[model samples]
Target: MRAQRDAPVDSMGAEKCMDQDASPEVHRFQVLVSLMLSSQTKDQVTHAAMTKLRSHGLTVENILDTSDEVLGQLIYPVGFWKKKVGYIKKTCEILKKSYDCDIPPSVQEICKLPGVGPKMAHLCMDIGWRKLTGIGVDTHVHRISNRLGWTGRNTKTPEETRVALESWMPEKIWSETNLLLVGFGQQICLPVRPRCAECLNSALCPYGRNPANRSPKKGSPSKIPTKNGS
Candidate 1:
């Protein structure tokens, strides 16, 4: 599915708001909750929902006990809150009955639970269990990796990218790869007018040197601030 050593890798990891003071279990649950909240939603909105959910007690039992109406109200700021509430409630029940009220550590097992697809399962397992069962190909990881010539093709779906990336990226790097790319995606390598000159991996990136980025006049103001300042 992929060739090894296709692209040179740099020290490409980043610690974002997600990694602060969070234990392994909390990180895993945060990944699960974030995946749920991220459906048709932005990261900031999902983070806010998780914050509110945490304040209201975020155990499996507690989450299951939350009424859909209340859950929807609490998560209304995110996209598709009403639908997400039902998925969350159902997922909690599955966790309690199938996994002994604990989130499963296995990526395969986690995928069996409701509302958890391969990408979500991988994210949960990596962050929650610190196990990189597979590469997590979120929008950013997929987009940036392809643009950097790490993968053979650009993909519209996360699953496709996951399968493709697994062939290229070593298991050791899988766990932290998404975290790094997501941060870079959010900050420098954005969808529009990416700050190519300021990108850390600019030297190794194919897209960074492409004509699209070099077309604009020199000394143009950066679309975003530096990571440290921002």
Candidate 2:
């Protein structure tokens, strides 16, 4: 998947924010901020928000110096923008006072920050620090994994799906799994009307094998199995 196309926009956005001449510490700090702004937000929106933030100096000091109203304006349209501003400010304050203005590298320490959860913490560690703490499960991963029978269909949350997947998925693919599955879910295994016929895994997928799982083609007979061996 990495060879097929560029990495997802959030990851790419983080890299874009990292100046070539910037120190490793600065790059990690920028990446952490990017990941924080990305929660419950679309990749393009997150990219735009980061770009706007960068325009005004995307740094822990700059963010803390900015007023909440200005910060909200900069990151407008992101879900819970007001709430996120508070979280970002609190996180920057922690980094400045406790961590000496450097983003913490440990998952436990990162998770202690406001608005930082397992998914965001894991993603920051993986992308910023090149550490594979855990799989970063989002809605796409949770839905697609259940649809593909990779996890129990009853798994109702991304965290549950993450645990179930880690139990069986090979350790080697842990870092790349989220990216690959997220792309697959967006382009092929869509939530409403997946492109099953075009999927490479269609033949091997239980959900894909059942034509009834997909909408019947126009003017075609229903594929749903009937009782009495019809």
Candidate 3:
């Protein structure tokens, strides 16, 4: 799968979704901000939110200086904007106090920040610090991993999926796994009517191979016979 060179881009991935040309400090800050704004938010919307924040000087000191109302307005339309405002502000305060306004390189330290979780911490570590700490699991990663039989069907959370995947997956691919699966999920193994026919892994995917697992097409019959002509 890694050798396939024609993979589609992940529009929602932190690495691809945010500005990549900034200095290390600015890039790290943008990555963290993007991850914070990504929860329950679309990639395009998150990108727009980051762009808006950039216009207002996206830095720890600048964010700390901005009013809560203005910050919330800038990150408007993201899930729980008001709550995120508090998280972002508190995180910036901690960064200023503890890390000299620079994003910490350690996953444990990054996770100590407000609103930053394992997923965000891992992603930041990989994208911002170029350190492969763990597989950054999100909803898409969780769902697609299960569908690909990389994890058990009962794997219920991103954290669980992360554990399952890391148990068997080589450490070398950890950094790129999230983006690859997210792009695959978005383009092929979708939550609704996935483009199974176009998927290279469809032959091995239980969900893709089993017609009964597929969602019924609009205005079409629900049941589909098995390959054995049942």
TM-score of each: 0.79, 0.84, 0.85
Cα RMSD (angstroms) for every candidate in the order listed: 6.3, 7.3, 6.1
Find the candidate with the highest TM-score and give its number: 3
Better of 1 and 2 by lDDT: 2
lDDT per residue (tens digit) for residues 13-49 in model 3: 4665555666678779878988999887877778778
What 10-residue stretch in candidate 2 is worst by lDDT? 220-229
Superposition TM-score, candidate 3 onto the true structure: 0.85
Give lDDT per model, in order.
Answer: 0.68, 0.77, 0.80
By TM-score: ranked, best first: 3, 2, 1
Model 1 alpha-carbon miss at residue 17, Å: 8.2
Clashes by residue pair, model 3: none
Model 3: lDDT to the true structure: 0.80
What would the TM-score be for candidate 1 when compared with the true structure? 0.79
What is the TM-score (0 to 1) of candidate 2?
A: 0.84
Question: How do the residues 137-157 of candidate 1 rate in per-residue lDDT, one tens digit apiece?
Answer: 777787887788776877667
